[model samples]
Target: MYSTRSSKILFFHITIISLFSFSIVKPIQAEPYGMAGCGLGSMVPVWKNDIGQVLAATTNVSFSSQTFGITSGTSNCTNDGIVKQKMAQEVFIAYNEGPLELETTKGSGERIRAMASLLGCPTHANELGKLMKEKHSYLFAKSNLENEFRSKEILVRLKSQIALDDSLKYICKN
Candidate 1:
């Protein structure tokens, strides 16, 4: 019973409504909860748009500090290590919120991981040990502690972010 022009108008209205709904509904929130459950770094640049600017700036600072260290010797490493640590701290400050921030305040695993990744992935276990000993005290009390802080941070953040209760738990196997 509908005319051709009426059918075209109905199609146009439906298209406009769907597009508007999409613009506001935020599809990224539906990303696998496993991704956002751990840390803001895994979520922000992926789920949200505004945080990329902060990430970009932090990346630049990390690269500059890392490059500066490479140009010098041990002194360069020391300076870069210090800068890298600070840069990681700043990134944590910029990205962290809610319960994740609370867990990091206790100790900073995500920050340490960010710093470790910035430091070009150490080759030897001893070297990694040395860096943790010399650099990332905020992350661990000892060089042996890499995942402790982040595990707790992620658990708490995930609990709240995903609205899970005593019935659920999220632990990273890796």
Candidate 2:
């Protein structure tokens, strides 16, 4: 048997954890599977914790509170986990396709870093930032080719980083 005082204390502890968990739960691994076979986005940890959403639509007037989703039919929306997987896959394809250079000296590099950061790969982001810092002259028409080479190099590097970084594995498994 628990006394009223102890019950209150336990309840308070749980309340604190629940409130704080929302801020960080997004970093937790998303659906083990990418969005493909998953039941819905509502089931994704990122969807529920990082974003507040409504799990289902209702015709009858009723108020309900839920974590993550704000819309009813958004269950199939791509979540962070899926985004990471897609990013990895895109890089993989680019690495092989040989249009290969990314324009790391421009906005494209920044976008890559941003994607890495969102995917929980700060190390990769820093490495990408460094690559963009390198200066090189671009020829009028040949400049495009050089830029593509640099970008491709960066994506391949990111592909390797995902292989080594533990945090990155959650999003880019295999």
lDDT for each residue of candidate 1 in 8-115, tens digit (9 for 90 to 100): 999999999999988898554434322112223323345334455456335434444323332232211333343344344333333443333344444444433443
Quote model 2's TM-score: 0.26
Q: Judge candidate 2 against the unseen true structure and give its global Cα lDDT, from 0 to 1.
A: 0.42
Model 2 worst lDDT window (10 residues): 59-68
| Candidate 2 runs further than 4 Å off | 1-75, 80-103, 106-110, 122-126, 132-154, 161-174
Residue 41, candidate 1: C-alpha displacement in angstroms: 17
How many clashing residue pairs, candidate 2?
Answer: 15
The root-mean-square deviation over C-alpha atoms between each candidate and the true structure, in angstroms, is 18.1, 15.1
Q: Candidate 1 — number of clashing residue pairs? A: 0
lDDT per model, in order?
0.39, 0.42
- Mind giving the per-residue lDDT tens digits that candidate 2 earns over 1-174? 999999999999999999998877766454443323223433445434322233322211122211111112133434445434444444333332322135444424544454555345545665543433332122111324454464445445555655564545565433
